[model samples]
Target: MTFAKIELTASDNAEFSNIGDETLDGLFGSNRTMPAQGITEFYGASGSGKTQIVLHLALFFLTHSNNPRVVYVSTESFFPIKRFRELLQQKLTRDYENGSEKSADKSKTVEEYGNRLLLTHEPSVESLMNCLTVRIPKLVSECDGIKCVIVDSIAAVFRCVRKSEIPYDERSRILFKMAAALKRLSVEKGMSVIVTNQVSDIFPNDVFHVNQRLVADKKPALGLSWSHCVTTRILVSKCDPMSIPVTLPGGKQSQLALRRLHVISSPFCPNSSTFFVVDSNGISSVHENPTL
Candidate 1:
């Protein structure tokens, strides 16, 4: 069957996001390429800074190009005011130190930018989807330019599944609906969508541990659905069992940074999954890949 091809917008010569630095490659699409507009799901344990990464990406889009407005929706009820405050302060500071530092016309342009970066907190999948399809589109139509959107954590929507009075198959269908809907919205609006997921420690039972491959067959159906819906699915987990301490700016407050890396479960990955770590400097790829 012959199919008609739609011409892709020339990426508007949108500069490719500077993905990697010294250590982390796929830290932010470092080794891998990012789709202009599609589903990107990051599955990791608690406190992996997955939400922070998505926020950073949105902030970059807003500050770098004033035209591309970013909409961030939270499904986990994980919207923290402190994080947004920190981000706002940083962006404003950057405004003060505008290029050249010579222009006396410290006009309203910079102030407007801070406002342009929109953030919405939706507590449920139903409400989130409503905002996405009805509210966001209208905002784009009436508002000046809106470009990118980041959903803090998509998996949180599933939490309602257990609470849902609906049937099992219906719940699964609901999950797929949101995923597919988000994909369509991203494509239609020429915006990028990044989602985060919660993962369970899935390993082969001790008896079946002799051969690791045999154990992998036990992956959960939920994980399978996530794989099917998202364009890119990356699994992130701790590489080593030993906890590593990381010092923060305050000089005393520190975090037990997880020495985790990406484990590619998708069939597309050939170079094994990439090892990544986020520490004092930020997210980075580890030098050597950890062994199973």
Candidate 2:
């Protein structure tokens, strides 16, 4: 019911990351009006790039920050290990080209970076709760500079629950308890908690559509119980695919699968959005100097 109180360090409240993208930086950076802590939920339909955005954030802290580590807890059956490694390599390559690294030991650097990222698999709600309440606090105690903890699709755990197996009241309590642990981890531990959530389609006149006053046709899963757990809610969605002309060796064109990230609710700025594309280089903002 309670997590052990850990002594907060001076740097615990220090700012952790700045996404290079202007759209995100304005909201999460030093210029942000809200304190740089608490839980952020990225909810969207499958293939909406929710995992990629969080992965990109984890990598950003790993590469850009002051020796900060990121804990990425994934409930997805298949974690994108190869893709994550590729992104890390690309970021490191860019840094080296920018004259950030003097040593030619790139492989060693990759290994070190890989170690800093603590990746764990929690396939069930019970396992997830244990990881959040027990394992995460242990990690924070043992590891210094653990700037952020990302749970890729926290919805996966609750999505598996059935009324026959777990009663509604029991489920709600579990959800609330999990959320409380996350809040404590964010506020007390002084680290940011990020979670991904799945979305379900809402038909016209649906109960949630009418009674709950949900404006979006596609609503993030976990209902109002888990919704209240998150300090900020962001919707990640896919846009219509468009073509971009490329000056390649044979003048080829590329089909860009654009993605949109909208701040559905936040204390700092609400109803803000930015479009981006994910490629071999990871997630990149589509518009330069995009205004939100």
The numbered model that scores best in TM-score is 2
Error of 2 at 222 (Å): 0.2
Model 2: per-residue Cα lDDT over 1-292, one tens digit each: 1112223455334344455455555554346433446678888889888888888777766775545677789897667889888988887887678676431245457777777777789999889889988888776666553677888878797777788888888888988988888887777677778889998877766674452234346888877788878887877877653334222222333456767777777765556666776777776666442232
Q: Return the TM-score for each candidate structure.
A: 0.69, 0.82
lDDT comparing candidate 2 with the true structure: 0.70
Model 1 residue pairs with clashes: 23-285, 24-284, 24-285, 69-147
Which window of 10 residues has the lowest lDDT sum in candidate 2?
Answer: 245-254
* Candidate 1: tens digits of C-alpha lDDT, residues 1-292: 1111122354453233323233333444433535544676666666756765566566556555524556778877656656655664555465567553422234545555456566778887678768766787666666653566677676676666664565667766776777776766566555666777775545545342233233232232255555677765555555454455443333443444445444344333332455455553445554544444
lDDT of each: 0.55, 0.70
